[model samples]
Target: MRQTARPAHPHLLASPAFEELLGGGGGPATMSALRASERSWRLLVVRAVLDSAGSAPAGPLPPPADAWRLLARARTVAEEAVEELLAYPAVGVWAAHTLRRLRGTAEDEAPLWVHTGHLHAIAASAAVRAGLEFRTAVPVRRGWAVLPALGAMRVPEASEPSEWAVAEVVARADGVRVAGRGLAGPDWHPLTELRADGCTLLLDDSDPYRTLRTPAAAEPLDHAAEWQRLFGEAWEILCDTGTGVGSDTGTGTGSGTEEARALAAGLVSLVPRPRAERFRPHSASSGDAYGAALASVPDDGEQLASTLVHEFQHNKLSAFMHLFTLYADQGAARLYYAPWRDDPRPLGGLLQGVYAFFGVTGFWRRRGHHALGQFEFALWRSQTAYALRAIGGADGLTDLGERLVAELARRLEPLLDEPVGARARSAAELAAADHRATWRAHHLRPDPGAVRAHAEAWADGRPMPAAPSAFGLASDGSTIVPCAPARGFDTRAVLLRWLLADPAGFDGLRDDPGAVVSGARPEDVDLVTGRTAEALRAFRARVLGGDGDPETWVGLGLAARAEGDAAGEGLLARPHLAMAVHSELDGRADPLELGRALAVADGDSL
Candidate 1:
């Protein structure tokens, strides 16, 4: 058998103030509270460390084992001091406040400095407890004292010092040569020594955290002009190749570079369009680029610029639909398609004229298919019909249906003609027939009164009657009526009917009792009868203090009620009609429905 993780010991270590608050108790009852207090302290320390490290010089630290040992020793000392304050509640509170203050000070500084700062704070406090005055000082080596402090306390370091000697490097000049090793994947690392010339290059074999910070190499012009030139060069490269090539292969060959440079120049000269933006390109090898948002033209600018314009047109059309109609939020108004990254060949240019025809039809439908409901489905059919007309009768009409009829017709048209073009014309004629059918369907009118009633019911909680009015009859000839239950006993009866009549509705109640309760109106008694009996059973369980088996029966009654069942049968079967009898005897049944249900059920049982 697998062993379960051991629960945290409350007395092993905790803030003195916390122990005092719980009256110095170390029992299981206080375990959760102790754990919460410990968590708060840990969060405070972590935040402090992160804050202090921000201003520290960027470089690899001493081995992790050495640092961890130093911190662990300091924690032991703090724990002892807290334990000593168990008898003095006021002192314990003061110590906790002081610990929080020290944490704040450490975090406000560099995060890397926190370990050293904490050691100093603890040592000073210990000295004060031992009746010796201690003064704070800035140690010459900054964070170096932490290691020696751990050593003095006989704490063993866990990590090898050599493993932490990572370095980072950067490029300096055009002609400088450098050899790198082991610097793969997504982190920055130090390169080999810089050449006599200004060139700086990345080293392949170095620690990942190691980095070199150098001034950006001097250009012939100002910073703004240099960035502009670079942006132009990048843009030209992208436009010419129609791809994002920089993420792989590093630098391209001479001709490719020249083409890229030219493209960039053109990009810079073109006026910045309203929607287009710029962004820096990054490589997978550098983790710094992982979540960084680089400037770039929006909408994944890999497609031809014209495609961007087309997408903008779709956005505008969607906005207009939202402004003009009620069902605008139903679904996507248009689908955007782009050639697969590895394949740039346009769909319109492939498969001879068939592909071009399909593209035109798809685009046209996207632009004008504004009919709602089944009419939208018809418009889709029309597109298929157009395709079939172009193909001619090559296939059969055996699979003709409201959907895909045009495609089926187009396939059939090819069989009627040797030339694909003649087949295409035949398919087009069949498609036009479907399109006409769709147009006629779009003009069919719905009952205006029903629509208005639905709209009102949705917007405002108006209680609609079961029977339709005269206006509804005139508009739709026949209106489907819904059941509407009255207040109190009648509503309870209706609920019982629904529970027996619709099992699916009861299933929903089982899945989510809260939803059922929320949907019930104030006049509805079925849910109240179920819920009240449940509350009473719970109260009884608390009063009698027995095992959970009786609570299970109460839960079953609640489940039945949520499913719209009459709780009368369940309550009558139970032994506790004594409370119900007493409630009825006191005449409390007059105002409260729950009291009334209990009185009636109990009286019948008696």
Candidate 2:
């Protein structure tokens, strides 16, 4: 008897097949299932260029004529970089990274490179359009590079994804080759030093690089030793860590050098092909595997190992997503709170984040047992537990997503349930609560129509409904991102936290007054810090000066809410939560949270 399979959801049936399609997070690819993987992102350049040229973007500026020419040249170089990678064996990590770029709808806040994939397409396109020409020659260690420079024209940082359209270097029998026009060689009195491991780490602040991008440091790299040390360390750490996941680099393979070679080979084959493509995400000393192309390699070996695992997982998923259904169709686009990010993200972004961090949590979990000291062990264990539970908060997963999540949970069950010290537990709790609060604030949108009705009745002296149903979810999550990225979590909280500090820090605060209070009224700081009597005196002094600032408005609302004011509460809640959320890593909020509205705020803080 031939049994037919049960029907798929209507949305899934209606779902179009991926043809150079974007955004499954980093799932399986569609177009590359048949065509060469290299073509995916290059095609994306064509689509994006055409769309932008036709649409006339909303920004004040107009598109440059050279934009098309640059886009074309960048596409060619990006394809070549991919082709260079394809020389290795199977498993389309390059395709994975590239497709992720092609499909992602792109958060306006994200850098161009991250939005596109593998190559820094946006920057590269601009460079070519400006009449920049690149030469073809492999790079070597000993002598100065002979490549000629075009001029003093400033260029975008070649490290960012959409910004950079080609790898700085490609592998060859003699040495690693340097690519890109206006790329002055070392012998040509060049500020750009080409390293053998396939990167153009800036040696000095020359014309274009200085104007184009602000890298963390312009110090020269000790190319050979530095590269060897990082690779060896990363390889050794992976072999020692048990919980490491992914195909080539994730497993606990043989010796350090052996693992390093395999991992290096895989990276060169995929990910912008940089051993350390440091052109993107300039100043953050954290984690990143951009569109799964490049991994920001810091000096520390352990950090490098975890980074390798993290980015590699992105590489794997970016490809795997094309073949599988990890998230539901209808709800996949709904924004959710990702513990690691300050911003709200759709299902695909959320999944990529979770998957990447899963490797991090696992590295720490396993490292605790191997080479870690006592303090390190406890820290890693607690952090791992924090991430494990964080993963559970994700919604909109399909059956496959559930299975994957379940499997990861099973592996981490021991660590998740493991007992830890009080400090560790407190940190974890704070982290969990923080994320829950952020999610509530970002995802929830009160019923504007209902609120309007209640407000109108109040204004008209008409009867109002008793139930709070007037304030509920929005029909559409329109107000999710409401304002610009905050300069600080709360300009008010910044002052409060400072003032709340003991008398010992008073001198420091007084010395640097600008940062202490920021935009908040100093008197409001006093009131929040329990200097109420003084605050009252100060407030009265300036009470009739003029219309209040945004902070004053926020303050009035807060007092009203405390005294049981409904209209005031709704009116003020919007401003109260505006960039008011704090992160454990101070001065940093999740990028996903930027410009999004929040339904929740830590009220007590207010």
Candidate 3:
């Protein structure tokens, strides 16, 4: 008799399928498989957590093996319910955090048992979902016992308070009870789901492991209805089949419908972050959390749609990285300047950013005729292309990474040629250049010997020597550079946005720059609004008077370049060099004259 062939144990992407994902063309099936792979990885991590728990110092928490046994028993009762519990994003985050603690790579933020005891809660949830009769003890944190995918229950008052309390979970076909109280009562907060069309998102704000940050004081989500409506509209935008807002200049592939399907499959929930400034969108995704995107309230449906797409792209790529080693050890420590980030990023991080922004580009490309859409499309397309070039030339890519980068480049090439309006294009260029120069100023230092040599020439009344060939990465003895997030308001960028999105508003700011933009001077408004000559004069004064403002230095270069001053090119391209030479001169030289001399010294014809 012929035997039946066995299928692949865990789903693996074939070469063609992998290439399709790299080119940004994957749907629900693709996402499901990636999630399955992630689930397998989480299981392996869970196994590791169990294996290492025995060697550690014992604590008051329940045994890891007991929790694992309970989970295994629940799986036998109902595999689907067990899988759902394991697949909840918080489970992955918990497992990763616990594994790090077990291996001594992370801090013991909580008792090791508290970390290992989460498995018990997950098991209880699975048992409850499966309608199986079981009893297990779950950790009560802050008087609440959280069951993954279920909800949280407030543990009854104990005789004595401790850092952690063990609550008994009893499940049956009728219902589930925690610490002798039924979940049907008012003490339980069930995970809320926001459903639009066929897509469902858990608007999770209750789980303790919902975020990687230190647990904040949990407040009631008073804005749940607004979030539900916004999510509904955003889902509609991603699923709408209508022609997009602007003229179709893009040759890019894929539609909002496909994106919506894939996104719905890959994105399990949205965890609300702390409220941010009005109209500003903020979001983040972790590799450990495969299906959740932590996001702040967005200004509108369009903003929400783009933010979801941007973060889901990160989640998707993160899943792929779990399955494949894209780059080798040699490239792991090498940092490259990212156009969107102020700090230097490693090769892998650069790839993640390119992939994430590529999704953002596609989102705006569909609406590239609208004013804001045109500006965003132009901005991210240029930035992504710039970063891709860096990735293509960087060392230490495995065969897989090479193909992935090639596919990304191939898809981005046509988008680069797509038409954008003159104003948006100029703003994009200025924004890209500003960020590049600012990052270089903060993170890349010019050679001290070369800087000193050039400074000496200026002091001795000699022609400036040739500019140093290149700058070195600044670091404080660590392999990674020590850099902080970009400090202060980006006044020029804000003005440019206003100039593109709301021309009338931008014009209104011309008279008083500080009216809307904090920390903006009159020259800052003038620079972005085309009063380059006036702005150049103000910037020179600021720099000459010992104002080491990064924005001033960059703005000076932009204004000078617009006025056909070649001298500004050197300062713009090498703000770190300009700052160094200025420091060497002790701020005695005329900023413009120094820029002019440096321009000639760097071989730029003036």
Best by lDDT: 3
Candidate 1 Cα misplacement greater than 4 A, ranges: 1-606
Put down candidate 3 lDDT per residue, 1-606, tens digits, no spaces.
011343448567966556657675566667878988987887778778878886774455567677777777777777777877788887888888888888878775467777778778887787777777887888777677888877788765731467567788887777788888898897777878888986898887877778854432223375588888889888888887211211122123556565577788889989887655433467888888899998998877888888888888889889988888888866446788777666677888888898888878888887676777888888888888877876886788888888878877777787788888888888877777777767766766667786888799989999877654332223212123346744533456767777777788778877886667656688977878788999999998888777867778877887888899976777776677778788888898777677777773434211
The predicted structure with the larger TM-score, 1 or 2, is 2
What is the C-alpha lDDT profile of model 1 across 136-201, one tens digit per residue?
A: 321112212111111111111211332112211112232111112122322212222211121111
After superposition on all C-alphas, the RMSD of every candidate to the true structure, in Å, is 30.6, 13.9, 4.4
TM-score of each candidate structure, all chains considered together:
0.15, 0.44, 0.89
Candidate rank order under lDDT: 3, 2, 1
Per-residue error for 445 in candidate 1, Å, reads: 36
Task: Report the poorest 10 consecutive residues by lDDT, candidate 2.
Answer: 278-287
| Index of the highest-TM-score prediction | 3
What's the lDDT of the predicted structure labeled candidate 1? 0.26
72 in model 2: Cα distance from truth in Å? 20
Greater TM-score among 1 and 3 belongs to 3
Clashes of 3: 1
Identify the superior model by lDDT, candidate 1 or candidate 3: 3
C-alpha lDDT (0 to 100) for residue 580 of candidate 3: 79
